[model samples]
Target: MKLVIGGAYQGKRAYAEGHDSIQKWANGETCPEEEIFSCEGMVDFHLYLRRLLQEGKEQYVREQLIPKLLQENPGIVLVTNELGYGIVPIDPFDRSWRELTGRICTELAEHADEVTRVVCGIPVVLK
Candidate 1:
């Protein structure tokens, strides 16, 4: 399975629509944060989403989820926000997460049979 995980809004939304639950093995509660979470900021869907895609989370997804997906599924096109491409996040955990998610996404895209970015609902193939 090939996935394009990012930190953006619409990208995850599209992926969310296809899956019944966002917390499922693929993108849903695929993996819980290993530590206790203290609600910060507004804790709205988006901010918490940013926290969900926080860097360390991807490692869990990669290890625990991706393999199972490949085993039971023939192919998958996963999407996530591109968080780290912009300015540095103020929070230490946030910054670390940005780098981690970015790196994982890059690896996923590289090994993907195809890779794309949707701008205004149009996908531009990157590789």
Candidate 2:
């Protein structure tokens, strides 16, 4: 598996696209929740995580969904925003989301075959 992270609109999707021929691309903000599992990989996974949190499904995501996806698709690539670099959010939920996202990213990075951080459309490999 591969993980790509960067700030919002930093061309993370473009970079991922350049690296692989993604057949399943789902937008976290708009894709139907049921359809998310059918996707081979995820772009803007932070947004999807937020959606899960909003729906009180975070536990399911952390315990079931992510593991299931990774097990089913070992080559899946996840693209997410690097949420820790900006000013901390004022809302408690936002703060929790940021923290959880960081933990998730850290875990993914540890297991990923490749980890990349994109800045200004340039990718820097970290693992």
Candidate 3:
């Protein structure tokens, strides 16, 4: 899998699209949860995690999300906002969502074949 991350509106999606040549992209905000396992690429992946958390699927987040994606769509391209750069949120759920997103992204980066960080529309490869 390839992970593309950056601040919101940094053009991560455009960069991923330009680089990956994927034909079918899923928007995590609207696509069904299971679509991640089959889509060629996905944007707004952080929102997907938030939905899972809101639904109290902590176990799936901790135990299955990474493994299932790696197994089912190892070549998928994921574009997610980098949620760790800003000030901490005050709400408990917001805080948990940020932290969970960080942890999950870390693991995803570790296993990803390529990790890219986009800043001001430029991509900096991390791995």
Candidate 4:
């Protein structure tokens, strides 16, 4: 799998699109949980996580969804916002979401064949 990450509006989606056609989920778009494994690529995955969190499926996302997606689709490209930097959120759930996103990114980065960070529209390959 390939992982693309950066701050919000940093052009991560644009960069990923330059490489392949991607199915995007953003701003609370409904994620078809059963169909994600068949996707070739996905963008704004953080929003999907947020949805899962809203649905009280955060544990399932952390423990099962991502692993199953990767196992089922070996070459999928994933684009997510980097949410761990800057001031910490005051809301407990916000803080937890940031931490969760970071941990997920770290895990994905470790297993990804390539990892890229986009900053100000420029993509820097990290691994």
Candidate 5:
């Protein structure tokens, strides 16, 4: 249900997006055009997502996004990159976002029934 997806966008992004699309397909709905969540790099996107998660806004995210997702499909596949695996960023704010997202993903992974790691084009199961 949760995965720490990592790879160059060309490779792994498709997997995450495709999986989400398939869920829509099964529900008799057309999948929307894929948005590249990793531009400015996956790390940046994830960091922004993490801040949203950690701030008091998490409840809003969950209330608005999670429940609707569960209602639409039996399974919810969260696609996120494994940002903690890389070198520390030079920018202080970038560094903070990395740490925040890394922690958020880690916690989610633990609660998830399964956790997967994607590297280059390879996937390794960690849980």
Candidate 6:
């Protein structure tokens, strides 16, 4: 798998699209959960984690989702925002979402074949 990360509006999706010729793409904010495993690429993956948390599926995401994705679609590319930056959130759920996104992205990066961070539309490879 390949992982792309950056701050909001950093053009991570465009960078991933330009770098890979993936025909099918899913938006994590709206796509069905099962679609992620089969899509060629996905964007706003941090939002998906937020959704899972809001739906009370945090434990499943923490325990099974990543492993399932790796086993089922190891070639998929994921584009997520780096959510741990900036001031901490006052809302507990927001803080949990940010933390979960960070931890999950870290795990994904560790296993990803390539990892890229986009800054002002410039892609920087970190793995």
Tens digits of per-residue lDDT for model 5, 1-127: 5454674462455555543444222110122212222121122336346556445555554455334433443244555666676789998766766776666566656665666666765667788
For model 1, how does the per-residue alpha-carbon lDDT over 73-95 read when each residue is reduced to its tens digit? 42544556667568897888778
Best-to-worst order by lDDT is: 3, 6, 2, 4, 5, 1
The Cα RMSD of model 3 versus the native structure comes to 0.6
Candidate 1 lDDT for residue 27: 31
Question: Which segments of candidate 5 are over 4 A away from where they belong?
Answer: 17-21, 24-74
Q: Each model's TM-score?
A: 0.54, 0.90, 0.98, 0.88, 0.55, 0.98
* RMSD of every prediction: 8.0, 1.5, 0.6, 2.1, 7.7, 0.5
Cα TM-score of candidate 4: 0.88
lDDT of 6 by residue, 1-127 (tens): 9999999999899999999999999999999989999999999999888888989999999999999999999999999999888899999999999989999999999999999999999999999
Where model 3 places Cα greater than 4 Å from the true spot, the runs are none
Looking at model 5, how many pairs of residues clash? 0
Per-residue lDDT of candidate 4, residues 21-53 (tens digit):
565433225657664677777777777777678
- lDDT of all predictions, in order shown? 0.48, 0.86, 0.95, 0.81, 0.50, 0.94
Q: Which ten residues in a row have the lowest lDDT in candidate 1?
A: 35-44
Task: Show where candidate 4 strays beyond 4 Å.
Answer: 21-28
If ranked by TM-score, best first, what sequence of candidates would result?
6, 3, 2, 4, 5, 1
Best of the two (3, 4) by lDDT: 3
**What is candidate 2's CA lDDT for residue 99?**
90
lDDT of 1: 0.48
Task: List model 3 lDDT by residue over 1-127, tens digit each.
Answer: 9999999999999999999889999999889989999999999999999999999998899999999899889999999999999999999999999999999999999999999999999999999
